[model samples]
Target: MSTSNEPVSFPAGLEGVYVCNTTLSEVEGLEGRLIFNGFNAIDLAETRTFEEVWFVLREGRLPSQSELSTFVSQVEALSHLTLDEYKLVKKLRGGEPMSAFRSSLSAVANGRGFKSWMNRDKAVVAEEIMTLCALTPEIMEVLHTGRKPKLKAGNRGYADRYLWGILGKQPAEADLRALETYLILTVDHGLNASTFSSRVTVSTGADVGAALTAAVGTLSGPLHGGAPGPVLDMFDSIASVANVSNWVAEKMAAGHLFMGFGHRVYRTDDPRSLCLKRVAERQASPRIELAKAAEAEILAALAAKQQAKALAQNVPVRTLRVNVEFWTAVVLEHVGIPRTLFSSTFCASRMIGWGEHIREQIAGNKLYRPRSYYTGSKP
Candidate 1:
């Protein structure tokens, strides 16, 4: 350790560093596991509804049946925007979906006067979370389809309503289950970029909406939530399993980055990828078939190239395998969700996580004030 009074050096990008503790979820990279609260995330994804997972992440235990029903009712009740909020949604309708969502949420936060959620009652925080969740799908649908979101009655639950609003019909059972699984799997991951952004903002005593606004902006970065659409684009460009290997090699040779392969964490497979792989398998689609074959060919080529080059074993390799985005693209496509709305779809589920972590950050209530090392010609 340096004896002098100077800032401690950290790894570039703060990789492998624990900035704060969280009870919401943990990502175990080496073992390729994710745990949400005390439950395995894979189990939760397979067995629980998005509402149930949201409750578990925030409340720290599974809700009883009555509790779940009440929570679902509460979410449904909060799903509709207020008159002014709806007007704001309408005025802000013609833009990128995420941009519209940011504006719409700001209106809700301002109208409700819901600043400083860190110090509010649990009920207030819950409302903030619910409002964000409910408003997101509507904003996305309006922006994507250029029409007001339809609130049809046959939608039985939050996920169903979300799909129905997006697709403008009663969603099939298969679609509903797949979308819910996607939401559950993406709900939280420990200290990811967006979650960290949320925590950082809330640590400064910002309102919940402000914190989530920061997170959405952070997630807008290409390195974060911007890969799913491109993954699908890559699939479209290749267009067939027989062409995947050549296409991957051509892209690699041209120094074009692969969209869905590498991850910052996860020494092994991404468990979310594994979970969504199962979801994709259940949905019969030509895209799924091409993706499965493409994944195999791509992984094999990447592995072979890595072995031939023989880089240092300790260095991080770009050979990191398929992440959640690979299968996520296929699964969402199979479920009839468009590529344009993919990142917004991710944000919709992640609102629950952002809220939970924001609450956690402020409950302990330490402002994030990390030190920095400056190297450029310091005065």
Candidate 2:
């Protein structure tokens, strides 16, 4: 018997349900696993460039040297944003940086070539990836600097060249390598909240541009992609080596969740953090030591306070511990990008993954609507 007043129960955890068929990537959260189109991400991070990862995400296989060359050529060609689009990004300032970037993406999607490009079939996903790879940097530049960036001439591959063009000069090899690694690491992560939002938006038949815009909006939230930039800010606030432990304790007492400490999925340390930290170590910067000390104190305190709170220091702290952000900050700072631009740079990297996921969603064509057992209705 069912009645309006009957009580119901909604599932607290979606343990097993076929919510969607996402070939763009898979994440085994409990096991702390991440894979992009069947390749181990850690292995790929060590061996491949961001462009190569992008190819795997979109094409379901890696690019051969000849294929990579052609892909690089196409990506390099798409780096310039049209004049009208640039104007729109310049006008999107004065609010939150992520919001401004998201708005800028929405504006770009409404422009010519967006609609037709996004809805193409799987066979043309490669072309769509090329278009997106090109547009992302321009969008990021306008959002960060509030000005149109000049594109550099010559073929330097997409990640380095796009960042070089945005920064108005070529990056040093180390700087370019850091940016590439960050991009590859961020390219995909299982069914994170933001990625799920992207899948849901695309499932409704939204254009790929629209889906990506929605995903960016999700990523802008503090709980999602917005934490990394602030992790650096936390480091800056701590200031001196002596204040590290006290500062962490004060922040924790104030009920502020440490920006770079734990993750929802990874019970152990985040694999990506390990790789980024190693890169930062090899780079041999001063900030790495500061980050390492900060991380040590924070972890010790967390363990002392709650025995069960032992989520092995996640990527954010590991990243900060090794001063990954500091190294990146130095490079980007030298190139004239402001501190405010860090998150936008992050967005630029993640956009590749977002587009790939959207293409995968479109290919699988499953409505991502998940059912919840009614908790309010009478039964």
lDDT of each: 0.82, 0.69
TM-score of each: 0.92, 0.84
Report the Cα lDDT for candidate 1. Answer: 0.82
Clashing pairs in 2: 5-378, 6-378, 6-379, 291-321
Q: Write the per-residue lDDT of candidate 1 for residues 1-379, one digit (tens) a residue.
A: 5555566677887787888988889989889999999899999999989989989987889999999999888878778766666666778776567777777777777787877865468667757767777667666666566566786775667778778888888889888999999999999988888899988998887888788888888887788877889999988899988888788888778867778887788879999999999888888767887888888877887787776566756554555699899989998988888887888889888888888887788778788898766544545
lDDT of 1 at 313: 67
lDDT of 2: 0.69
> Taking the tens digit of each residue's C-alpha lDDT, what string does model 2 give over 74-132?
77777677788788778887678778878877777666455533455655654554576
Task: Tell me, by TM-score, which candidate is best.
Answer: 1
